[model samples]
Target chain A: MHELSIAIQIVEIVEEEAAKVEAESITRLELDIGLLSGVERDALEFAMEEAIRGSLLEKTQIVYNFIKAVMVCEECCNEFNTDDYFNSCPYCNSLKTIFIKGKELNIKSIEILKQ
Target chain B: MCGTCGCGEDEHITYRNPNNPDSHLHEHSHFHGDKEHSHAHHHEHDHSHPHSHDHSHDYLLKPGGGALNSQTIQLQRKILSKNDLLAERNRGHFEALNIVAFNLVSSPGSGKTAVLERTILEKGSDFNCYVIEGDQQTMNDAERIKSAGAPVIQINTGNGCHLDALMVNKAMKDLKLPENSTLFIENVGNLVCPALFDLGETKRVVIISVTEGEDKPAKYPTMFETAQLCLINKTDLLPYLDFDLEKFRQIATQVNHHIEFIEISAKTGEGFNQWYEWIVKHRLSETD
Candidate 1:
């Protein structure tokens, strides 16, 4: 699905960054995919396996950090982890909640090898 | 890489005008991070030109790893930044051209095209509208919009689930949209993927029919959250279906406080007046 596109984007961004540094190859790629980012991890991983082939990331170890969605309840002033945005607060059963995390889709870092 | 760029032919996104049916294939690989990605070609025209080129610098083609060094580069960059940057460029272009662009997003069969068709037909002699129809693979919507008396282009994203800003930019180029006009970009019929992609539209209108139920807002909160206007379509069918309109509004408002509601029926021409008013309000951008 869109994970394929996201994987392609990841590869493109990492490759571009590596190119600027004149890196020969990327040894590792660290990705931060929040649970609420709407991207499935398995889908992205599968896509990455195909996306990295014949590229600098061919031999690279890909690491995925699936961040959990953190929500802050406006009623109880308590913070909690949720799998989705619609989850009511566990502590207060309040629907008036603000999302603090788990929507992040970012490239945390990359281990590049230079020649 | 299609012999020159590192991209394959499958990565090409086609923009086709329904009236003409001639597609313009644009490569997405080159449009990723840089405007141009160039690497020295080492393969000969004849032989087994091994596709050994890794996505790295030119030196990787050579042998020695004796001078190879590895380092952990810390860059917490958003992966979609490339798309976002292009989206901003699109916004700038629309601003310069004085074109008010609206990104229409919804699920399949939610009457996005129907809304456009009715809007274009009913809003006659008022504003010039250009349309960009995005689907996985179909010219049906484009053809429908063209028949609705508006210049339309169809973007058939082969395997792409959602339309990105790059695709919209390319389509915009092909459309050659007139100044002081309206551009309706009907995004691929998906609530999940399209939520993350910013197409730089003046206003994002998310459409949902009564049959979709109230849970749609809660299920796809991101889509509802990001959108500024939520068009509740198929009000005519509400008499038959036990669709709770108040609960839907409640859930939608909870997800997006700033979102405005417009109950429209693209079929019976009911509530087209409010839709047109909303369009004019956004086209003028509330400055007036």
Candidate 2:
């Protein structure tokens, strides 16, 4: 799955950051993965386990925070949570809506042991 | 790091010509600046040190404390920002060279290769056309484009589902495309992953064949939403199939109101004039 590639990217980024800080090893990693980010959480976790071997994050504890998709209706400006893209506004029944959240894929923080 | 894929820059991407079995492999590694400091800002640190006087116990404990003194560093950065920055660099390069790059995306069997073949055949003589074909394996598509008379490079992505910005940047270096030229990047045949990657193209074109069903736009809204042009290919078979063109258009519009559509038949050369004209218009505007 594409999650493998994403996991590899995460590992690469953390390794680079860890090296910059002169970290002996990474102890913890926090990630923000949104529902609309197009990433499967389980697959990413599994991939990370495989990708982190023999790397800076070999023994790191990974934490993922799932963000629910929130939509803002363009017509009535009503905010609601939704998982589907074709959903309409509940208040005005308008099809025109934009996602205000739940498209984020970010590295929130990391705990590293200084060398 | 290799410039071909953003996931791991060190990963090697093989580029080869289909016609020549011994075609020299073009290998390039794009190393972004290594001097950049870590964006990690230390927010909290465990300063408690469990100092042990026993010589044997001290060897087991870390220098700062019995356990490693770890600090939580806040980054709060987008995971794909590296790819985005590389994409912006590609966009700037294209602009400086007066090149118009188009990223063509679609599902497998969507006639992307056919449409490209037809386009090159019709416009190759008038324009300096170069193509970058992305596939999991094989140089078949590159061969087709080469036969069509356009200089082509094949990117074997291995297990990659999409071509990221870095790959295009690497291909651009190997191609060394001249000014006032047109570069078409045929992305890997997948509607899901490619939607998330930006290859720094002048415009993104998503092609869907009538045989793929009318609900494709609704099912894969992200691809349609990101694309500027939606080409409904294989219109020649429209009369023979149960495909509803109007319904397809309506659904696609509902998903992406700003996307423009063109009904085309790459096999019969129908509706290609408008497609060519669209390219010409965008190319001229890009230069201005």
Candidate 3:
């Protein structure tokens, strides 16, 4: 699955932070996963946990914060969030809207053991 | 019973002896009276006070430490910026070579490789073409292209869902392509992840075949909308199949009005000339 590749990135991000902070163990990892990032949260967690073993982040906990998908109306400059990817703005029926958010995938923070 | 310093952890339990220090119930860091321990915070602190250690707490806050905060922010920026640099480099490479690269996307059986093979055999000797094939495992498509007598480099994505700019950069090193070449990258067979990654292509071509049904453009509009051209392949079998050419184009146009449409039969050589003329026009337009 693509989650495995993203999981590898998660490990790289956490390990980089751990080395910078001189931390021995990573306790928790926070991520901001976009709604439209095409990543399943549970799959990412499972992939991260499995990939972290035998690495520097053996005891890490991965927590995901999902970002809502927001689109901006081209006609009225209105922004709205919708579960449907192709739905027009609820406020206006403008087809000229562009997706503003919900494409982000980043490691927000990493909690390393404060040793 | 008295509350000490308004800290919530040392709540007065009626059954416990207040004078005995053992009555101090171990509470979570949120109620640990440390204002710095807001939510999921971790740090080192010299807590030499006479108390038991609780590493089981969700996180420990390091009091009087500001350096760690900046280091965390710096690392986040570095990771993202590194990838951004590689993507920008890829864009520059495509531009300097004067190559109008279009990333081709479709499902596995949607005839992407077939369309490419047809395009190469028809216009390969004319356009100075090259292909970068993406797949989970195997150099089969690249080998097919090499047999067709065109320069091609196969990039085994190796479990990668899509082709990123960094991968393209590595594959470019081995390609013996001339400057001003027409590069076509056939992305891994998927409709979702490939839409998200921009591989520094001049255009994105979304190929849909007659057998896949006409409702595909409406179902996967993102791939259709992002692409500059949408090619509906397999027109020769339209008589045998229920595919309507006008209906498919109309649905696609509703989603992406500006998308250019091309109807070609890659197998029967019916619309290959029109496809080649379009390619030649695009390539020749680059200099003008």
Q: Poorest 10 consecutive residues of model 3 chain B by lDDT?
A: B1-10
Docking class of 1: acceptable
- Looking at model 2, residue B22 earns an lDDT score of 55
Which residue pairs clash in candidate 1?
A55-B55, A56-B55, B1-B5, B1-B6, B1-B7
lDDT of candidate 1 over B157-177, digit per residue (tens): 765667778788988988998
> Which ten residues in a row are the worst by lDDT in model 1 chain A?
A41-50
Go through the candidates in order and give each one's C-alpha lDDT. 0.80, 0.80, 0.65
Per-model interface RMSD values are: 10.5, 11.3, 18.1
Candidate 3 per-residue lDDT, tens place, B112-221, comes to 88888888887786777888887765667877777776677665544445666666665565564568888888988888667756677777889888988787878776
**By TM-score: ranked, best first:** 2, 1, 3
Going through the candidates in order, state the TM-score of chain A alone for each one. 0.91, 0.93, 0.87
On DockQ, the leading prediction is 1
What is residue A71's positional error in candidate 2, in angstroms? 2.3
Worst 10 residues of 2 chain A by lDDT: A41-50
Q: Which candidate wins on TM-score?
A: 2
**Tens-place lDDT digits, model 2, residues A1-115:** 5665566668888888888898877777888998878776666666566567667777677788889999998889999999867787899988888888888899999988763
Candidate 1 vs candidate 3, DockQ winner: 1
Candidate 2 per-residue C-alpha lDDT over B207-252 given as tens digits, one digit per residue, 9 for 90 to 100: 9999989999998888987899999999999889999999998888
